[model samples]
Target: MNKKIGLWDLVFMNVSALFGIRWIAKSTASSFGLGLGAIPAWFIFAFIFFVPASLICAELASTYPRDGGLYEWVKEAYGEKSGFMVSWLNWTSKLFWYSSFLTFLMVNVAYVLGKPELAGNKIFVLVCSLVIFWVLSAISTKGMSFAKIFTNIGALGSTVPTILLIAMAFIAVIAFGYKPASTYTVSTLMPKLNMDSLVAISAVMFGLSGAETTANFVTEMDKPEVTFPKAIMISAALVAGLYVLGSIAITMIVPTDQITASEGVLVALDQVAVALGIGHWFIRIVAFGIALSVFGAIILYIASPIKMLFGSVKKGVFSDSFTKVNDHNIPVKAVYLQAIIVSAILLITTLLPSVDAIYNVLVTMTALTALFPYVLLFKSYIKLRKTRPNEKRPYEMSKNNGKAIAIANMVLIVCIIGIVCSAAPVMPSLGENIWYEVQMIGGGLIVIFAGLLIWKRFTKRTGFKESS
Candidate 1:
């Protein structure tokens, strides 16, 4: 197997993973709260939150440099049990996100086909989404080469359309002397801290989240200690700039209050095309690109966690079945298993009346799943500083370990607050009762703890150990 992934390949994967179609989904959603003003805030948050987090992860990746990424870092700093929980949470979160991506893709396709009424038809969406998922899962099982091709194509397919849309919007503004939808103001730029505003802000942060996925590629790089951090910094900056400009362009054409999660960006693009007297051809192309982007993201969604699962199983956290890779060096069974779980989640969305509710629940669940790893990750960072003081780290937060820990702690606290506030009630009419929201959030927590307990018991009974 070719274990070495090149620097350019690393950039593609990181860019693919970081921006993907979800960033667009997020930028589209941001219209609900900050409108055009949210663009700069999104950029600011990315630098403030994502950059430092990436640096911390880069230090960890350099010190460890393993396939399972955060899972390995936690295990090295903590122990087997904590590592198992972290790995499981990371894996499951990816699965939840996979379903979300599939939903997004299906919804967009339905709209582009002039079947807007079918957009909320969960049965149709779920069925179509499952078909796409299985096809991508099959290609993923063929190996990383096929997967990389899709990721690269998907990355370009999605990004180029966004860049075109931004360019077109700029031309329209200059040619027609059109003003922005909302006046840019300092007060308008800052995120609101109330329940309604916090939920919207949390959605914006979701776009900036997930940098740790890039750390998983460290083992494949020739000199990961040097190259990995460079890729992360470059990728984060590029993604943040794209997000800010894209959000600004879309909101410039559409009123924020009129934006719906489902049709915001498309509506903006359609209006821009009309205003420019260019017809709907550009909008159609944009829709196709968005569809391809979501499809590509779904492909990576299946591929990434399966790779992580295979690594974790090899490390003894999961069953041997997960370690069984085909002649292509792909975990066929693991990929299918992931697809099945995602399909099940998609199927359940059909029964739920509110697709937004489903989206919110899935988003909250993803944040919850992601939080477990960050908790262990911060703990791991502290422990590694003290326990493995002699280890050569290519990068460190600071010479003072306590100061690093304090900053990491602060980031963790912010993450926790974001997660909690995400689950908090937002609007009174849209089933945003606090108690109901808590039950959903609480239920997700219960499932996570249950999974942890089950893994712990299984490990004990099976005599699983670090050396195994």
Candidate 2:
């Protein structure tokens, strides 16, 4: 409806969603392997996971090019039940993921205030998390013109700080003669296919991910078929490059054990500044940038999928009143409704053992729930190829070569493995508190399956039977 999302708009939107170099901190901190050992997982997952997923999303969005891009794509292939299921998982994933990023923002704020330990302060975290979520959520209520500003901020905010950090790391290496803690050899860079390696690879699903979701805004794009695929590849390449380079930068300074999963990037930046003989002020500056970048990311997650889900309302499945847009053409009801849901999740998270536990649990559950929807996306790609043989695909993978479907199936397997591995704890540090993993896997499923009843009730209320 709103064509404000041009090519560059989609580009930065991808930047906001996919190019979170903060994930370098998250990935290197995860089971992705120790330090530089994690680098190989990037390439491995990129080929087997990200590349296929990106192709799938690009073609889906290009062919469908509708208001609810991914939802419409899946529905065309498998019907409404299938479509709503994946959309709901994606929406829920963001719901939990938002709280985690808010926690990231709160902790980074604590670092700026020179009380890095305040990240553990429950009241501070709760209040800051709620305040930040609501404020950004409210700003997002204004629709695309306003949302674009934050996304532009997201592009600049995320990239600039990461570039600076990489530069500092290179300076640390050359000027200070700081040798990196890990060395790169075939043994270290070559991936091991054990269970730990499997779990670690899933981190890529979380990091250097979400380029596919740009399809959510396909309808808003000026020339979506042409723009969407190009933006996905370009943004993903830049995002991936920054991720590996940033990983090298951070690992050059902090040892594997020193890198905490949550706020390791901030800590690494601080250590790098000290090592470089720069004042601590650089840490504060970058911390501010981290806060902005995380907020930029949070805004994109909150705005898009909720709008995608609002298509359910337009279909007469949700109350028509729920689809009300503001003067800015933004879905006002969905924006506030998602804020309410995120608040409830943050409230539920308080029951966890500690602040760190809360952050870890929410993030783990977020990552876990995100995969099911991804698996659905891959399947939708295969199904669409069969169901719509002549669907004017702007970005079709030449299936005549016979290699495309094989690669796509590999992507499907990668998604399934991530979901299976998600059932177990990805982080060993949390093994002492095994309940966190239980809550993550158990809790995430309850939310997803519950969507079935909701979808059923909506269809029933409308007296609308989905076509078989």
Candidate 3:
């Protein structure tokens, strides 16, 4: 093994990928009726979904240890058709997520420019999103070297501003005597078993996801079997803690009613600055930092998923041109294809009522589609443990197969429940709108169905067989 990446390197990479400050905003917004109960909701999902999913990923990575993450594991357990479905879902989910996330970036950029109202203007949003997405897409084709620089800057952007937000929130509440917008009592902290709360809890899964992205670097680790497990546990704890604390910080400052999913972080930061007797300059600075982080994250989403999809599948999965890479080792054709699809999504979202509405629908769709793969993932883990009992696993999720399978099933159940709840409306304006409901449930089905059609067509052309 080259052993280039150590435990800390893996830990930080996981943290950067898993922790997005924008998620704090989205989570707090989703916690609409739950109030402070959203904090415990984070812990609940972290245990049932995030933590177990990480362990399953760790075991899968160690056992397979090749480049493909979800695709390979699902393929070995099911077949190439299942594998392509996972990859297709994984890739397509990011397109919706990119719209939601990039719109968030533009929302913050509006704050930075002192034009907060522009965040809601569809034309302004559309123009800025297209420009930023294409510019980054062009840079991504240059090579990974350029993208790595932005990635490091983005990691800092996500971390530093989050720490500052959490600290400032407490300081405003304690030292400055600014009363928290919501009360956090024992009763208030208990998550309700209602539709709204379940919707919010499902959104938490989005915040804690991407832990498996770390598995791609398995080859660079020293004693990856031992190191991967330890790193995932530590990073999982850190990511979960930050999400809970950050969500609390946001709710503490911004009143629940005023919080917008896309702009809640900016709102909370503004409240913090006002309460601390600081200038709006502080808000602008942090907004700018968050925008940079969003930029870096956008680049990663654009390139990594397309790259992984191409890397995991055979040549016939897509046309030959789509599989070809340029001299810089960039999948130019695939990247361009993703950019076009995402652009179409962005354009179609103009029909949405507001910036918040656009974000809510896209994110709801993202959560529902994104979590479905975990169903297949958990199934893969259990099936592999039984069918390939003697197979080498660098870091098994559990020594006892019964215990491991149980844990996987538990995670699988949580995913199913979360996916169901995610179909509910996240914003009040959309609560009564039948179209919004259709968009949520209907959009997810369309994505999944499209993937199936493509997979069947490709598999037939390739003459792929289960045993092969």
Question: Which candidate has the top score in TM-score?
Answer: 3
For 1-468, candidate 3 gives per-residue lDDT tens digits of: 353899999889888878877767766663433556767777777777777888888788877887678989899899888888898889888888888888888988998998888888878988899888888888889887656677888888988888888999999999999888987889867876666666766677877877577776776678876888788888878887887898789889987667777888888888899888899988888889888888777886578888888878766878879888998877898888888988998888778777777777777777878887888888988899888877877777888888988998888888888788887654456444567777778888898899888878876887876785
lDDT of 2 at 259: 72
Backbone collisions counted per model: 0, 0, 0
Taking all chains together, the TM-score of candidate 1 against the true structure is 0.86
In candidate 1, which residue pairs get closer than 3 Å at backbone N, Cα or C atoms, i.e. clash?
A: none
lDDT of 2 at 418: 76
Looking at candidate 2, the ten consecutive residues that score lowest on lDDT are 29-38
**For model 3, the run of ten residues with the poorest summed lDDT:** 27-36
Off by over 4 Å in 2: 1-16, 30-34, 138-144, 190-197, 214-236, 299-301, 312-314, 325-336, 390-392, 426-434
Where in model 1 is the C-alpha error above 4 Å?
1-14, 21-37, 138-144, 216-234, 313-323, 326-333, 430-440, 463-468
Instruction: lDDT winner between 2 and 3, please give it.
Output: 3
In terms of lDDT, which candidate is strongest? 3
lDDT of each: 0.68, 0.72, 0.80
lDDT of 2 at 313: 30
Cα shift from native, residue 468, model 3 (Å): 7.0
